[model samples]
Target: MYVAVKGGEKAIDAAHAWLAEERRGDTSVAELSIAQIREQLALAVNRVMAEGSLYDPDLAALAIKQARGDLIEAIFLIRAYRTTLPRFGATLPVETAEMACDRRISATFKDAPGGQVLGPTFDYTHRLLDFKLAAEGEAPVAPTREASQEATPHITTFLKQEGVIQTEVDQGDTPRDLTREPLELPADRALRLQSLTRGDEGFVLGMAYSTQRGYARNHAFVGELRIGTCAVEMEIPELGFAIEVGELELTECETVNQFTGSKTEPPQFTRGYGLVFGQSERKSISMALVDRALRWEELGEDNMGAPARDAEFVLYHADNIQATGFLEHIKLPHYVDFQSELELVRKLRAEAEENLASAAANTVPEAAE
Candidate 1:
């Protein structure tokens, strides 16, 4: 049982006041507006939205401003605010084939259908920093092309047609919300994907990297990576028909792993899928790798005793909010617990000294005899 300690309210209030003052540093300088943060620090805002499980750019920017540019703190703030929101309804499954793509690329096929579109990427850029952006400058305009009206089908579709890749069959079951329901062991693919999409980026990346280092390695090849805006539709109770609620910018990744087949079954390439909010390509790829590693059981592969394969460990530890809460709580007052441990250690030492002294005394008498 935990007891609340009194008499520190004033100190706590003072600390909060100082924090606020620190957040608004240098009053002489122009304060950053929410718009500026939302537009300029987009990637950071995307990270906050992805991890916080919230999608409001304005609110994310506000959280970033309030948290003094701390992404994790912004995510925490967003998540705390999300609890007060009313749930209207769940959206239907998004169709990525209909996505208005900004960037699309495939590593498996060089001349894949729909062709490659490298949109607003840092992949081809040199590592050198541009000093011109150090001072005030006008926003640079980018070159544009005529928007294509063609639908960009997934590369996996072609592979599936050739019967080279494993086919995915929807069970038609309502996916369990990890936020609402307790995460049970032996989680389904849907639950695992939900957890991973909102999971800590660094943690997921590390787990994925472990797989590449031969810990439950699946020899993954990026079949397709696409970033685009997809329409989110929801069924309105009053209307009785599904309507577009909003559009969400998403990054989708499909990885083709080594052929896994048994004597009874023919060899077919397995697949690992990842879908995340915003242009989080790295996170999406990492998620796919980790997802594939966890699917060893379903794929009928041997357990390699990898951390990535341990579903419970990955899911539980992947949540930064929960991990940080437990970690930061250790900084709180534990005087009673510490005192108990201190007393026990002192008693043990005293008893050991007494026993040593008694043994010495008995040995001295025996030596004299």
Candidate 2:
């Protein structure tokens, strides 16, 4: 018999140390600071922030560097770090009508009151790789446009005024966070949005794309996509009022979709909503489509068993951190379970051999008789 390995602890520690050394990479050349990754690798930071459900890009960048740019690892770091953050209290509901947007666009309207500002997007750029950017360099400048001080009216609100958009009454105070509490079936808008905000961007995008490909097709039109900073304030119990904690960058998308006329309803346009931690328009837009699709049952429509229509499926499978952890853990040892299965198979084979011998002996007696 072979001796079982006993160096697991030492091996694990050595592997982790080697990983840390690899992440720092050529330390003599100077370590790439977190600030550099936050500013220069903005796109990667955005991806981490989107999935981590946290607003700080600097923290996300640091997590990425620490994780050796293994994105799933970085996401896990953000999620774990965010869980420990002390929640002083809930902030006042952000007024999207006054987002102070860096980017705002509505496909439902030809010319919105604020005028569509496509700020800091790669939408129109060709997909050519620039060799000049191989070495780190400064980004080119774009002329800044003057922002309006007056509050910009929402496109959905305009539709609501004219009875075009379906009006859902406010449900008093907002719902609880799903992370802190166990997820109950039939989650409210707040919980649903929270789950989607931290969901895998690719998975969410595929689900949204599936809607277009005839699975619970909602005929969605992007009502608006806005990204900007908003003030976060928490109420102090002793002070009896909310104070500004800080500011956070957010991306909000609203979708207009078709609705059905039921026994108690009239045919009207419905809504799908998505909101995320950063200026992630693509993720927010995808999230909005998927959100609306999931509401098919609540809206009194047919449950077509679409991926997006399954709330449990979407909510459970959307987190990359959980997915990757479970996935990679399979690489770890499972010798005890394997040995049990091996023993069971050996016992079964021995029983089968005994039975065969008994049967053969009985046959020989019958032949002799």
Reference-based TM-score of each model: 0.94, 0.89
Clashes in model 1: which pairs? none
- Summarize candidate 2's per-residue lDDT along 133-192 as a digit string, tens digits: 977687677796755545777889888999977788887876887768866777876788
User: What is the C-alpha local distance difference test score of candidate 1?
Assistant: 0.90
* Candidate 1 wrong stretches, greater than 4 Å: 1-6, 263-265, 364-369
What does candidate 2 score in Cα RMSD to the true structure? 3.4
Which regions of candidate 2 deviate over 4 angstroms?
Answer: 1-3, 135-137, 146-148, 237-241, 345-369
Candidate 2 versus the native: TM-score? 0.89
Each prediction's Cα lDDT score?
0.90, 0.83
Best candidate, lDDT = 1
Pairs of residues at least 3 apart in sequence or in different chains that clash in candidate 2: none
Model 1 lDDT tens row, 1-369: 455678798989989999999999999999999999999998888889999999999999999999999888899999999989999779999999988888999999999899998888999999898887887788688897643457899999999999898888998899998877778888998999999999999999999999999989769999999998899999998999999989999999999998658644468898898998888989999999999988888777777799999999999999988888899999999989888898899999999999999998888444665
